[model samples]
Target: MSAFLSARRLALLATRCPRRTLSTTPRWSADPWPLPHTAQHLSNTQTPSDIPPPTPIPRPGESEETLRARLVYQSRKRGTLESDLLLSTFARDHLGKMDETELKEYDKLLDEPDWDIYYWATEGRSPPERWAKSSVLEKLTIHAKNEGKVVRRMPPL
Candidate 1:
């Protein structure tokens, strides 16, 4: 009976332990994800030059209209609705006063995954390396948290 129990324990241990080393193979190739039809349509609708450049500061002689338009578009269209409202409201409040450097950093933050930004903004996760820069992101994160404070909906109609 003791030998049988020992064998059962060994079998349990074997089942729980990892059998092989994790694979090092990359899941995705170097190519960017294929654009869906909507994304493709949006891209085709605007020329590369017509799109605002992603640098923190606008290029020398770049127009304010271009910067404003880009900021509005980026802030409003985050992949999820929650991020969209949070970012857009923050942008509307602060983008006008942000210096060229702040604008650039905000642009970089926009490049990160929406989920990461949402997590950081809500204080659900620490800011990762990509979010380390940019006072703008810091301020935006605070704003996102504040958005959680406001009453979300009327209790009854």
Candidate 2:
């Protein structure tokens, strides 16, 4: 009876404790669930560098209507809410009447960082020397002043 009980105890211990094999390779590599190929590639890919890509140039011989539509879209979609409202409102009011030169200038303004443009428009910070003489910047600043009307939302595109 004593020998039988000891055998039963050994059996229980054996069932409870899993056998661990010594392996030089990592256990994760042996996992049954494999990572998706795209996910694995992304994990190994280098992170984006600090330098921004070059600004996009307008398509050659683009129509004035197309240019205005593009600029209005850009104005309405500025990442920051303040700039979005100000620029979109300005675009709605002024873009249609702008000549080719003014439209080009406004395109250059859109290329600037949103916060910088916002500050310049609001007179919170004076524009840098490069932008000081920009007619588009002047127009944006005047619009941002909201002289008689309060601008609370982005105007429809």
Query: Where's the lowest-lDDT run of ten residues in candidate 1?
Result: 40-49
Model 2 clashing residue pairs (backbone): none
lDDT of 1 by residue, 1-157 (tens): 9999999999999899957777788766432543323444334323233444335543667667677668778878877766787787777778888877777677777876665566667665566555676577779877776746774321110
Write down the worst ten-residue block by lDDT for model 2. Answer: 40-49
lDDT of 2 by residue, 47-145 (tens): 334545338685899998899999999999988677788888889889988999999889888987776678778876677776899988998888888
Clashes of each: 1, 0
User: Best by TM-score, which number?
Assistant: 2
Q: Highest lDDT: which candidate?
A: 2
Q: How far is candidate 1 from the true structure (C-alpha RMSD, Å)?
A: 14.6
Indicate the residue-level lDDT of 10 in model 1: 92
Off by over 4 Å in 1: 1-61, 147-157
